[model samples]
Target: MGYIAPESPISDYDRDVVFFEGDLEELDFEVLQKGMELGFILEQRQTKTGDIEWVARDVRKFVAPPEKKVIPIPTSTKSKANPESPVNIYPSSYRTFLEKLSDSLKSIEKINDSGNFEDAVFSLLRLLGIHSVYQYSRDAQAGKADGFFILENLAVMYDCTLRNPFEEYKKDQIENYIHKLSNKSQLTIETRKADGGRGSKTLQIQGKSRQVWIITKGNTRELLVYDSIKVKEVAIKDLITITIEHCRELSYDAEHLSSKLVMLGD
Candidate 1:
């Protein structure tokens, strides 16, 4: 290893020449020997202090690399859900949950849709260890939340309903429900905080959470709304498709399986 720089002021005539100044080690010798074919001329010089220093002159002319073009990323504009979107396929720890979700959805379809739908949803949430309470208290705005659940410090207030044809009226109703829930949740948090700092202790994170609006249908398409706005259309045709798609999204540590060929000689 040695110091490399222009031998002198980089003039037009000597622009290609670069100088290396220092003692050359074994590593330096190996590197110089390998690069000898690259037109790098190596020589030795004695300094005034009686020390030997290596000199390497690069004969190749330097050329700058081409500048890369800047590409701008397109922003999202509430893109419609695509059922044909690619999903990852791999082994996951949540494989059992995916199976159970698939089985539950199928079983619910076989039973009475209107009567058993809410119960089934609640059961599924319970299985996921999400504690739910029905008909929770609303704020002063009379925004009625269908249900409430506590996830760690996140107070999730949700509205569960069965909508047919998925019209604007249903959307408005859900929006109203979310408004009420948000107001109540905020008020509750403030009250808890005022009461000897109990609120801060209970809800470690203090903020309005996104409203979960689960809109189920017997024949029409299924939808999952957040804060009264439609997010996922559940556009897939069957439960297996939905399960696989959702599971793929949920799976972060996906493993890709591959096979390799080997050759042997006698």
Candidate 2:
């Protein structure tokens, strides 16, 4: 017994070889080719006992979906403010950089690159005076979240997505991140100093007093709940606003931002 290719025409059969039950004439070439392309073709065989048999072949072709064309969103332009204003707490150069960074984060096209977006968010968190920000690798394991940060007594595990609301925020993915968070009772994170020195320390998380936040460009609201764990949402715009406010006034610390997040959860 031998398998025949689906694309082989029935008319090209050897005259001496006989087909079982004269089924050759009933075979449709177009249907066979289409089925083969779709990996659904079945092979017909004849046993030594003159019995006809059909067997499925393990042949599958995976076709990737077409790439999506992302149209760049127009970034909002902020008017220039007086550099000599007393409220400007940062240097002129740093203030200009913060404004540009804010504009970049707001643009959909810029944040679409996950690596760049995560880096920007990490920088923003650091600028907001949250000293314990740890960014995970982009190719982190299944249950790992994008980044982790501490806010006073609160420990936040966050994932950033620039996609449409609820599109990339699948329930399974949220559950995975929650599982990662639940496993950690305490974490040791490394911090870098400007003098090119590195240091590590452990941060204790008080029982289940942790939060999983999805930072997105879309509307901020409660997204999902699994078991007793509630997954909350926060808009990136809110984070940018807090950063700007913190730049102008040092009082908008991580504790203040943490309170704002808790209020959003309510």
Best by TM-score: 2
lDDT by residue for model 2 over 59-132, one digit each (tens)? 34424445544433333432246333333233346567878866765663356786677667777778766777
CA lDDT, every prediction?
0.40, 0.59
Candidate 1 on 221-252: residue-level lDDT in tens? 32454543332222112323433453444111
> What TM-scores do the predictions have?
0.34, 0.52
Off by over 4 Å in 2: 1-109, 139-143, 167-169, 188-202, 226-228, 250-254
**Model 2 pairs whose backbones collide:** none
For candidate 1, the TM-score is 0.34
